[model samples]
Target: MKTVLIAGFNGSMGQQAVKLVNSMEGFAITAGLAHHLPDSDPTSYGLPASTQLFTSLNEIPAGIADIWLDFTVPTAVYANVKYALTHGYRPVVGTTGLTDDQEVELKKLTQDNHLGGLIASNFGMSAVLLMKFAQEAAKYFPDVEIIEMHHEDKKDAPSGTALNTAKLISKNRPAHQTAPDETESLAGSRGGDYEGIKLHAVRLPGYVAHEQVLFGGAGEALTIRQDSFDRKSFMSGVKVALEQVHTLDQLVVGLEQIL
Candidate 1:
């Protein structure tokens, strides 16, 4: 049985992880960190009473944890991920808003240290498939654009999902071509463009997570979309990462490699 230490073990995803481990026979939990959550919020989320609540990662005791599950905020990511590696622990990070440059540096650190780190922008299998499909289709429809939406409380604009999607799509395709427009009235009317491909971000209440890829062709158009209505949808992808962390000693950025 794999032993896990949860970083944001008081939140929605953390709670789900607890239940998954509790119901499953092959895994056991070592510790849980609930730094920023209210005392009562974690109860419904399935955090055990034996779990210790702390404001920092420094409080975690050494030599007992196998996997460090991070479901915390983006700002806390670098510090915690570093701590895990320094202490010879594996990490499965689901936090967003970390920069591309930061990711490159983390990958290097994971490689140099020979420690495993899994960082996923979106932990939904369908969303992963959407990215894969877009990447595959990019060769045929090189003029593809992306639109992403999420809950209003989410802090990041142009979420990691959209950025990663654009990056993947950009890798296999040439920059899309748009006809020159002589009309100029509203500045920023065309929305933010990545490598000549348009990207739109929407933030509103009552939306979980959604993304769509619009591919334009000569007199023909193709569209691909994926949506997650509830937080539980991400658990499957998280499970996959946790299962794979043991055999890896390198930084894995996407779930694509495991899939």
Candidate 2:
């Protein structure tokens, strides 16, 4: 059985991971580290009684865990992942908002240590497919725009998913030389620019996670979209990373590799 330690197990996505781990065989949650627990117990989120819960990473036993599942926020993801890698523990990060420099450092650290780590902005399978589809469509399109929607509680706007999609599509863009705009329109109508692609971010209370990429050519448009209806939808991606962590000892930026 693979022993997994869940970091930030009290969060929304963390709770989902908790459910998924419990449902699977040949895997067990060794322990969980939550910044703080709810009034009741961790088992309220379906964590097994066999799983120990701690408030801080400092309390975790060294080398006991095969991997650390990070479902925490971006604000704390970097430090948590670093701690896991430094101690020879693999990490699967579902948190978004890690900076480019942080990612570079993360890959370097993982490679130097010969340890595996998986980080993805969105672990929903459709989300990965949407990214891939957008990238493919980019090869033929001249303009692209992205729209991402998430829960209001998500701190980062223009979610990592939208930005990453833009980056991917921009890489294969036509060489027609369209300058990335510097225009100020309707105050915030242009959204944020990732390379030459325009990105729009939306936050609402009822949304789980949703994104779409619109590619416009001379007279036609193609849109690829994906939605995570519930937190449980992310379980497949998490499970895939957990299943593949041993085989890949390098940092994987997305779920495309495992799929």
Candidate 3:
């Protein structure tokens, strides 16, 4: 069985990962690391009696687990992933907010160490498919815009899925593709612009993670959308990453590669 460590084990996504790994075979959780945990026993989250939980990464001993599954927030993600790599733990990161430069550096470090790591923006299968679909559609429709909606509690604006979609579609489109001339009376009404595509973000209650890619042509428009109504939607992708990360020779940044 492969040993596992969970980061952010108390959050909704973390809890889901915890439950999933517990139910699956050929995997075992050795420890869980959260910012803090309430006064309770480990089994409360279905952890085995041998498993432990910690609030700080430093508190854990080295070589405690073979790999780490990170569901932490963006601000803390860089340091957490670096710690895992430096300490010889392969990491499967579902955290968002890593910049392009951070990704490049992480890949180099993983290669240098002769290890494997996975950093994914969205772990929902439909979301990954949406990104691929948008890239394919961009070859035909050059003018596109994106709108992403997530729960208000999500800290990052312009969800990682949306950013990845824009980047993929941007690469397929020609340079200097222009949108129609328009005027915005309000300062931020047009949303953020990446390449030539407009991106809008929405945060509200009662939403999990959702995105829509709208492509406009002369007389018709095509919209490709995906909705994740629950946190469990991502568990499958996380499981896939965990099972497949060790097979890589370097860091991977998207779930689409494994799928």
Candidate 4:
């Protein structure tokens, strides 16, 4: 069995990871790491009594887990994954705020350690497909924009999926301005720009996770959209990563790599 260590165990996605690991046949929870916990009692968090719980990175014993599954916040995720890699744990990261330089550093660490790791921006199949489709559409239609919506509590703007979509679209679409230079009556109304692609981020109480890629060509327009109604939609992709991560020799970004 592959022993798993879950970081940010108290958060929503972290709790989902806990459930998914427990339900999988060949995976077991070895420990949980959180930035802070009221009590050390494992039962309080619905974890097994034998599973070790740690509130600090330094306190986690090395060699306790084979895989480090991270769902921590943007602020803590980079450090958490770095600690895991240095301590001999394979990282399967779902947390999305890691900067490009941070990822490059982590990739170097993985190579030096000869370890396997994955950092996925979105772990939902629909979201993954949407990015793929958006990349394909960009080749034909260079004029495109993206809008991503998530729950209000999400810590990052221009959700990782949206940013990743823009990166993918940039790969196929050349660098060129799609819209004319116009001043907005209100400042900051055009959304963020990524290599000429306009990316709009929406955060509201009722939304789960959704994205729309709009493309305009000539007199016609095309829109591709995807929605993740529940967090469970991501677990399947996580499971796939867990089962296949060991096959890789270096850290790679995107769920599409494994798929």
Candidate 5:
């Protein structure tokens, strides 16, 4: 059985990971780590009785778990991954916000340690396909924009999926989009720009995670959309990453790599 440790165990995604892992065979949650209630008992925080819990990676004992599944906040993700690597545990990170430089350093660290590490922006299978489709579409239609919607509780803007989509689309496109030289009465009406692709983010109570990539051409416009209506949509990808991570020699970014 693959022993797993879940960081950010109290968060929605972490709790969902616990449930999914327990439902499957050949895997066990060795322990959990959270960002809150450091002085109190972790068991009281609603976890499986067999799983131990801690408030920080510093408190986790070495060799207690093989893989650390992280769904923590952006500010803490780098520290969590570094600690996991230091403690000799492979990491499957779903938390975003690590810059390109940080990823380069983490890749080197994983290579030196000969450990499998994953940093994925989105874990839904449809989302992965959506990005692939967006990349393919960008070759034909260089004018594109992204609209990403998530729950209000989500801390990050533009969602990692949108960012990844923008990056992928920008990479495959042949030329920069034609600039619209129109004046805007609103300062932020055009949305954020990344490689000339406009990105818009929306946060609402009813949304889980959704992204729509709109591509414009001469006469026709194409829209590629993916919706993650439930948190469970991400668990299958997480399981896939967990199962395949140990075989990797270095850090891999994007779930598409493993898929």
Candidate 6:
């Protein structure tokens, strides 16, 4: 059985991870880490009595788990993942807030330690396909813009998925201005820019997770969209990552790499 340690165990996504791990056959929840909480009793959090609970990274015992499932906040995710990598736990990260430089540094650490890990921006299969489809469409339709929507509680702007989509689109689309002389009547109205592509972020109470890629051609336009109606949609991809992460030679970014 693969023993799993879930970080951010009190958060919404973390609770979902707990359910997923419990429901899976070969995986077991060995421990949980949630720094924001004062209570360390596993039973108080509705976890199994046998599952160990920790309030901080320093308190987690080594060799307690084989996999580190992270759904922590943006501010804590980088440090959490770093600790997992160095301390012999393979990571399957879903928390998004890591900068480009931080990813580079973690990739090197994984290589040096000879550990396998994955950092996925979005685990929903539809979202992954949207990014893949967006990259392909960018070859034919270079003039494109992206809009991503999430819950109000999401911490980061221009979410990791949106940023990854932009990077993928940039690879196929040349760097050129979409509207050279266009001026906004109101300041910052056209959304954030990434290599000439406009990216708009929306956070609202009703939205789950959604994204749209709009492309304009000579006389026609194309729009590709994907939505996650429930957080459970992401668990399937997380299951795949857990089963296959140990096969990877080094840490990699994006679910597409594994897919």
**Per-residue error (Å), model 2, residue 49:** 2.0
lDDT (tens digit, per residue) of candidate 1 on 1-259: 7888888777667777787767666776767776665654344557555555566777777766788888877788888887888777898988887887888888888887788879998889999999999999998999887889898877777877788888998899965677566465787656677877788889999998999999999999999999999988998888888888888879899887777
Backbone clash total for model 2 is 0
TM-score of each: 0.90, 0.93, 0.95, 0.97, 0.95, 0.96
- lDDT, candidate 4, residue 178? 53
Question: Which ranking of candidates, highest lDDT first?
Answer: 4, 6, 3, 5, 2, 1
- Candidate 2: residue 61 lDDT (0-100): 76
Off by over 4 Å in 6: 175-178
Candidate 2 on 49-155: residue-level lDDT in tens?
76788877788777777989998877888899988988888999998889989999999999888998899888889999998888888888858788999999998
After superposition, candidate 1 runs with Cα above 4 Å error? 40-45, 178-189
Which pairs clash inside model 5?
Answer: none
Worst 10 residues of 2 by lDDT: 176-185
Pairs with steric clashes in candidate 4: none
| Candidate 2 lDDT (Cα, 0 to 1) | 0.85
lDDT of 4: 0.92
Kindly list the per-residue Cα lDDT of model 6 for residues 9-46, writing each as its tens digit.
89888888888888889888989998777776787766
> Across residues 1-259, which tens digit of lDDT does each residue of candidate 3 receive?
8999999888888899999999889999998888867845788877887888888878888789999899989898988888888888999999899999988888888987888989888999999999999999998889899999999999898888899999999888854367677788998899998877899999999999999999988899999999999999899998899999889889988998878
78 Cα displacement, candidate 2 (Å): 0.4
Relative to the true structure, how large is the alpha-carbon lDDT of every model? 0.81, 0.85, 0.89, 0.92, 0.88, 0.92
Ranking of candidates on TM-score, top first: 4, 6, 3, 5, 2, 1
Candidate 5 lowest-lDDT run of ten: 37-46
Write model 4 residue lDDT over 1-259, tens digit each, in one string: 9899999888899888888888999888989999889889877777778989988999999999999999999999999999989999999999989998999999999988989999999999999999999999998889999999999999998899999999999999965555789799998799999888899999999899999999988899999999999999999999999999889999989999999
